[model samples]
Target: MRPPDNRRRRFEELYQANHDPVLGYVVRRTANGHDAADILAETFMTAWRRLDDVPAGEKARPWLFGVARRALANHHRGERRHTALTARLASELSAIQRQPREESADMDALAKAFEDLSDGYREVLSLADWEGMSIAEIAVVLGCSANAVRIRLHRARRRLARALSVDPPGRAARARVPEGDSA
Candidate 1:
């Protein structure tokens, strides 16, 4: 049998080779950078624990991806609980980091607009635009038809446009003008 050190070195070699793809899989499944990093760590930990199951050659990437997918799902479920706890303890940390104090007012307004959107619209935008998933991937994640996703995405864009326009000073004035009324 191979020595323990040899088995470990082999596992390290396989892990190093497949790390990037595994990380990309985690990133795609997660909501943000930090969550992706956590999932990636958990994926490697699983790999280390189950090194014997990892095939030595061509199948390694897929095996790692499968492990990553399961880890990501667990991470997502845990994240929901963590978010609820964190919201009570410290709200808006991520949002505050993304937006400076000067822009906080506009950000707050924009956030309200986003919140006003229907759940379907919000989820579609979050998965497709914010999380950057492909329509096909989003369909799988949301358990919806692809054409349905496309239609919802279109309506969501229109709704967002309307919301933004209504909040803009000039556009708000124009929208309020009566038909055939001169500016």
Candidate 2:
């Protein structure tokens, strides 16, 4: 029972115990087997590095799942950025194009508000609302306490609501112009 000897055996046991389930989790969510394998490998790599951090018992599975969830998110984010870059390049290269459709003013305002949110607030909201993850699940992914996740979620929702309720900048400025003084 030394640093790595103890750690290695424990990790081997963990990997043997959970590898199939972890693989299945990733494979179910990912589009391709290759990507699933990659994520699975990365997940185990993280577990290897943080072997001491894995929970002592049943919580280990959920903890690994959380790590896999983050790896998947990172993969998707990278894919989306790549796709956006490709689309932008295509749009620039195209000589002829129809005028872009106008989004609703409300949608424009909402998008601006979302963009203005801090990364932590946006991530918390996305995990809670967009991903439909429970508070416990989010806490696992974020490596925080359930109470912390709950508090963060509450604050994020309040911030989003406040952001959504704010008037568009132009309208707010117009409202500030004292009646006749249209400066």
Candidate 3:
């Protein structure tokens, strides 16, 4: 049973005789070629390790088929576990992505409404609100006096606030109140 040269010779004979049948058995059970290849390797590895357990003659092929079947089952179980983990991670990722976006929907509406404003109003409001520019800086950019920039900024803000007032909150801010309905 512990004779090294004899053991190797027997395993080699068994492998030569049964490699194709065992591979075909595993390949038919698994979807992926790689999985089939791996299961085949594992089956042969098991046969080599348990050489004494392997039967002689025609019985040896059935014994190898049984080993391949079990290897294929183990491979399928591992695939199921991997698939379940990916799905759980995707669910968690989508939940995280949605939370911030839900909070920003109102901002999306505000930006949409802002787009409909006259260029002057948009410029003045963007400078004051988004760019964090001072009246002096805005006047220089607009080529207007500081007092004029102040007046334009104030008017732009009032107009924006009035525009927003008509918009139902938590809806697309892009919707416009008809000029007739601006009351």
Summed backbone clashes in each candidate are 0, 0, 0
Tens-digit lDDT track of model 3 for 34-135: 888899999999999899999999999999998988888888888999999999989986865677876667666677778878999999988987789999
TM-scores for every candidate against the unseen true structure = 0.43, 0.49, 0.52
Residue ranges of candidate 3 with Cα displaced over 4 Å: 1-3, 101-183
lDDT of each: 0.82, 0.86, 0.86
Best by TM-score: 3
Evaluated at residue 96, the lDDT of candidate 3 is: 59
Residue pairs with colliding backbones in model 1 are none
Q: What is the lDDT of candidate 2?
A: 0.86
Clashing pairs in 2: none
Question: Which prediction has the highest lDDT against the true structure?
Answer: 2
Better of 1 and 2 by lDDT: 2
Off by over 4 Å in 1: 1-3, 84-183
Summed over model 3, clashes come to: 0
